[model samples]
Target: MTAHERLHTRAWVLHPDIKSDEDRRAAKPALDEAVALAAALPDLEVIGANIVPLPRAQPGLLFGSGKIAELKQTFSENKIELVLVDGPVTPVQQRNLEREWKVKLLDRTGLILEIFSDRAATREGVLQVEMAALSYQRTRLVRAWTHLERQRGGLGFVGGPGETQIEADRRAIDTQLVRLRRQLDKVIKTRGLHRAARAKVPYPIVALVGYTNAGKSTLFNRLTGAEVMAKDMLFATLDPTMRRVQLPDGPEVILSDTVGFVSDLPTELVAAFRATLEEVLGADLIVHVRDISHPETAAQAAEVDSILSSLGVEQDRPQIEVWNKLDRLPEEERTALLARAERGAGVFAISALTGEGLELLLQEIAVQLRGARHEAQLHLKFEDGRKRAWLFDQDVVREETQTEDGFDLTVLWTARQAAQFAAL
Candidate 1:
């Protein structure tokens, strides 16, 4: 490649700290995360990052005129080719900013869409990303460019200007959205079939969820012995991965590693990826993994919980909080965290990277999954040997007696185990 072509695009990340917003995060960590997000995309050299404090956002340009002038001067001096805003930017604001700065501009949603576009691996993931990107693009088609107004000729039989360039483009996007929806529906149907198949075999599903870069993938790898992409990078694991793991002295479970949640995740993405996130919805237990070493661990956990709630996870769903990354904490802090975990029900402190406290965590998982056990009797026909064998395999059967037409077995099991046996 030529030197010119090889040069990475110079980019600056700006996280707007809105002073008026009571829920606004601290500026420094937010800016750091925004910079990391920018760095996740290929071919972008993040030269600098800062927190742009605003008492109120300007509707036309996001930043006030003075701040815009100052930023323009900084961009020119730094030879920046792109400005990435780490918050929502209106289409008008985006256009105005790009024109004034004479460089490309991408908002938080746009940047995330680009990252998802690059990271998607599976067919469903790709389709989901495309649908989300199109949804985002549809909102930005508000004459951001003069070219969108340019008209093209249609069939001679048609009337005036056919449709405007913008109309044709939007219609094209709508058509593609429809096509993608059809393909995605098929994929979702296939996924449902797989879910049903798994239900028959019915190992309890344990889902791992957390904020981005919270070592969920690392923990998933350590627990399941699968080579999922685990990295100290945001959105490293996009596609949901499932593996069957047998707990020591306990029942086996299907462990699902899902996409990590982030604060202010794009609405389009949440909608498009609903089918994928269904894994979490169907989980028998939710493990909320946390990077306990991070400074904003509490805030991050809140964000994850908020997203889970938004996704319609019921309040009564069994959940365990895993305080991960203990190895990264200082000795005193680690000891304190461990002590705190001891006092907290359903909370465990561990380092996924070092396999610390995993044994206790596993035990807790098994205990939670066991639920409440009760004695019950099940009747099975001669042709239902498989069901009877499954009950035996689960070690839930207490006694059995053969009748002329069937076998009556008494079993002591939790409702979860009984449900699995029934599915068999």
Candidate 2:
């Protein structure tokens, strides 16, 4: 059977300690993200959902006997071949739950990993996802390798066949993991070299980052006029795409579209994608695109901020909040948002799909970039022709005068570039 044809599953939300109304309210976004993910699965059907409020002492199964019985009956009635949990599950707990329910059980991490595996297109992306999957699977090796014992007899074994098979699988995975890491390291080094070259040219890097489906790719295409894959689906763009964009002031900058951050993103995937995310760390500015019409905009913004902080991108870098999709909002609400944005709120209300208020946003970005530029007057010895040529290539020289023993040049550059020039 085809992959889509064989794909069938049911999903549910189970929060163990949503004690207060506030806690439940906070969990609603996670539940929404889970439901959205399940709906995105081509062959999956969400036939049942349950919010189990089990105590910590009995956290293993995440449900009481009564609740388990109810879930089993519902699964049987709905013909659910797999169970997708909205939270992480311990390896033992996952095995036990699958045995009791007589179906496959995948926790939140596994589900996200599966989606990433399916969405990965480029070789780099595939390698990163494979590394993450292996890392995650290593912790659940017992459950994963238990079935290796059923292999047919092929050779005389001094050790038990099952033990040998398990050891072999573990060793193979370890070897593969090492190879993948090496490949990724090479890719990262190549990227670093490219970044260094770009720095020499010194085009301001503006990275677009936000929650999934917040129109980041759409805005990226709109700004850069590059047709990247922009869809309503979750995690549409896995690989980072960069294009040169001319600002309103006629200054050019490199705009990058990064992978969208989601609530409760798998830690393994995050760790794996660090190389890709390094772009954010090196950015001159970050454009945080938010779906202003979405009810969870603030929370989504918080999640993005948390991820940025974790990636070490929170060190005094400028961030512009672009409240996008204003076309979806009512006129009065949109006006209110715009008014708030106008009051020096570090936010811009725009519609990436419709190009509404984009000119103003571009002008704002240009203003920030202009502010980031620093002009320096340096006296270079006349014999230092190479340094003069490098400075001309590094930045735009506004003025230059030949002196008796030296040449005085005035150059405009970003602070980082200024440091590099000073080092020279």
Best by TM-score: 1
170-228 in candidate 2: lDDT tens per residue?
A: 89889999999899888777877777677656478899999998999999999888989
How much lDDT does each candidate structure score?
0.87, 0.79
lDDT of 1 at 206: 92
- Model 2 has an lDDT value of 0.79
Please provide TM-scores, in order, for all candidate models, with all chains considered together: 0.83, 0.81
Candidate 2: residue 265 Cα off by (Å): 2.5
Residue-by-residue lDDT tens digits, candidate 1, 31-124: 8888888878878999888888899888789999999999999999998999999988988889889999999999999999998998888899
What TM-score quantifies how close candidate 1 is to the native fold? 0.83
Candidate 2, which segments miss by more than 4 Å at Cα?
1-25, 48-50, 57-59, 142-162, 371-413, 416-424
Please estimate how well model 1 matches the true structure, expressed as its whole-model Cα lDDT.
0.87
